[model samples]
Target chain A: MSRSTPLRGVHESLGATLTDFAGWQMPLRYGSESAEHNAVRTAAGLFDLSHMGEIFVVGAQAGEALDRALVGHLSVLAPGRARYTMIVNETGGILDDLIVYRLDEDQYMVVANASNYALVARELADRVRGYDARVTDRSDEYALVAVQGPRSAEILTALTDADLDDLKYYAIVPGVVAGTPALIARTGYTGEDGFELFVLNEHAVPLWNALAEAGKDAGLVPAGLSARDTLRLEAGMPLYGNELSAAITPFDAGLGRVVRFDKPGDFVGKAALERAAENGTRRRLVGLVARGRRVPRHGYPVTREGAVVGEVTSGAPSQSLGRPIAMAYVDEGALEKGSLAVDIRGSQEPVDVVDLPFYRRSK
Target chain B: MSTIPDDLSYTKEHEWVAGIEDGLTVTVGITAYAAEQLGDVVYVEVHSEVGSTVAAGDAVGEVESTKSVSDIFAPVGGEVVEINSAVVDNPSLVNSDPYGEGWLFRVRVEEEPEDLLSAAEYTALTSGES
Candidate 1:
């Protein structure tokens, strides 16, 4: 059975199209997904991210346990800092991408994707068996809502007394928002300035209503998963199943810099990841821009000189770029020549080989 | 709910057929219900040419949204007498005015159409679907 998020009632009352995503009934859109995408790019948009997982690791050796389990240097991270890291298997395959926030001296929170959080929590629990840390999956107790876009800070600053100006990007602080306790994190997946607010599940409705009221004139719409997917795509960020998978590693997806071998102690997949660095990947991910309106979707074959050279992973008609763009895993041969075309339903449409980040914020 | 005009006939495929009283020359397009589910249409491609033959339930065109693409099926069998060049050039009309300016093709009927639903029946089909 598909579970409902804390804000499911609000979404239904607003006439959203609810779809089953990753075992949860989530809102696909409010009305026009393109408009929601544009709103986040130009103004601000609200997102119900309660379906995301929040796992806590608390103890004297919490940071040490994370360093041994993942592929990042988490021990040296400051209290207010957050680091984006990943958990890999013994074969150096990526399990899930995570964000670890050091909340206090003995406390750290690991934010995970809804689809893989259970497995990630289990993995963390098992990895910390000998350590002086305890892993707890507290996803059910918290609710998350994000206000994203260029005008997010202005809108959020109105509702909270916290020092929004002093809060740098990738930093987290505990504060009260709209009369509810929340962890304000200056991080987002949309490649825009935004804050992910984590509060008690019962406080979700009031917080959403408050943000909606505060950002009424600033064009803050209740954005859904449809717009979120496209916004992240425009930013060239990878989704778990689309770009990063159990069969693919960080090195293959052009995100090898995330794995830090220089960190102390033996971490999981360290040996295999070291070999991946010396010998480059066989198939690499590249960006493809369609010459026409045909959207190059996932699993579509990419060809070069009449031979299959790659496969499309994630694709959509980009509203920001006003063209169809895709990320594909191509053979090393195609990556070398930078020449390829996507076979979109038996027709070979030529694609311009471009570097990722199809659209960028002014910053 | 989308508007289902009582004056027109519909297919289970969610297309509206019109101009039937004009001696077998009928105009066809996807109904407003189908357009809403498709989100914002970015591209439209009609496979039936002005003189090509089409059959009912055949995929004669393609409508693409940002996240997905759906095939536009022919509601009735006929020779494609006309294609809407306006919709081909500008696909957003499919969402803006699906039954009027967004009509996909016109057919010179080859035989009697099959499985055409009235506006009430089409309304019943889409009422609790979304």
Candidate 2:
């Protein structure tokens, strides 16, 4: 059976074309993918991200338990702050990339990808069984909505009592939005100024309606997964299944900044990461900007001459750049700072290996 | 809501063929349903050029959108007389006006196939019935 988000009916009512995404029936678009992408780039756009998994860890030893299970320094994270962390298996493969929110000293909320929820829950539960922490899966009980873009704050501030202006990036606050008690976080998948509201399933409809009404004056439209993918591509964020899988380590996937090897605590994959850091990974993720409008799609071979050196993990026409771009895992030898060619549909297109993020927000 | 003109014949894949001023030369483009499924076509790649012989189901072109890449199949076997260079430059024409300006190619049918569906039959094929 397919899963449905709390906002599934709302999406359908808006003429959204729905598709099976990560086992959930989610909207691919409402009208046009470009319009939705531009909405988030220029103004603000709402996203129903309720398909994401939310796991809560409570008990006196939550921090210590997570510290041993994940790779980030979670124990130092103060209340109201969130940190991006990763769970690796015993063999040092990534189990899931997640965000850990320190709700309190003894309570932490771990948000993971929907598809990997059960695996993550099982792994964390078995690991924490010996510790003093209790794991609870609250994914079905809560719904998540993200309001993203330049004018996101303007629209969100009007409906929520949360002092969003004071909330710095990656911070979370318990607040009320449209009269519903919620956790408003200053974070998003799209690399735009945004707020993610976590509310009860029952309050989802009213909260969505309220945001839609309040955001109308600000040009905020309901964006779906199509726009979400392009926006994140422009932002140079990695999707779990596409970019970061169990076969790819954080360092190999260009997420080295999120891994803190200097932290004074032992965590899963710590030793392997240290060794990999010293020896360097054999493959590195790089960005590919195709010369023409021909977008290099996933699974297309990345070739240097006639031989396949790598494969495209994700590719699309960048809504912000107005050109085709992609992320690919190339051999370390192919990571040379120069021009490379991506074999797209039997043709070799010259690509510039310039930088990771093809687009950046103006401060 | 756009009607597939009765004079035009269609394929199950949502391609429509209309006889040009020359009765032998038929212009082809995807139906509205095909355009809707492809979504915001940003690029088009026409591989077959003038004088290239193609089979009925042969892929002669590729249409790419932000989310997917769809193959433009030949509706009738014939030598390509002319490719629509305009649609190659601006594929959004396919989404905007799929029937007229967005026509993909004009082919001179070598052997007219009797298996082409009528406009009504094509409509039912896309609408998920017969």
Local error of candidate 1 at residue B34 (angstroms): 1.1
Model 2, A1-363: lDDT tens digits are: 899988889998898989898899999999888999999989999999999999999989898898888888887899899999899876567889999999888999999998898888888898787789999999999999999999999998998778988899999999999999999999898889999999999999999999999999899999989999999988888888889889877888878777787777677788888776777887788888888778988889888866778888999998777789999988888767455788877888877765878888987
Which residue pairs does candidate 2 place in steric collision? Answer: none
- What lDDT is obtained when candidate 2 is compared to the true structure? 0.87
Q: Against the hidden reference, what TM-scores do the models get?
A: 0.98, 0.96
Q: After superposition, how far is residue A53 of candidate 2 from its true place, in Å?
A: 0.4
Report the lDDT tens digits of candidate 1 across residue range A63-153.
9999999999898999988998999998899999999999998899999999999999999999988999999999999999999999999
Best by TM-score: 1
Q: Which stretches of candidate 1 lie over 4 Å from their true place?
A: none
Worst 10 residues of 2 chain B by lDDT: B121-130
Error of 2 at A23 (Å): 0.9
Docking class of 2: high
Q: Model 2, residue A51: what's the lDDT?
A: 93
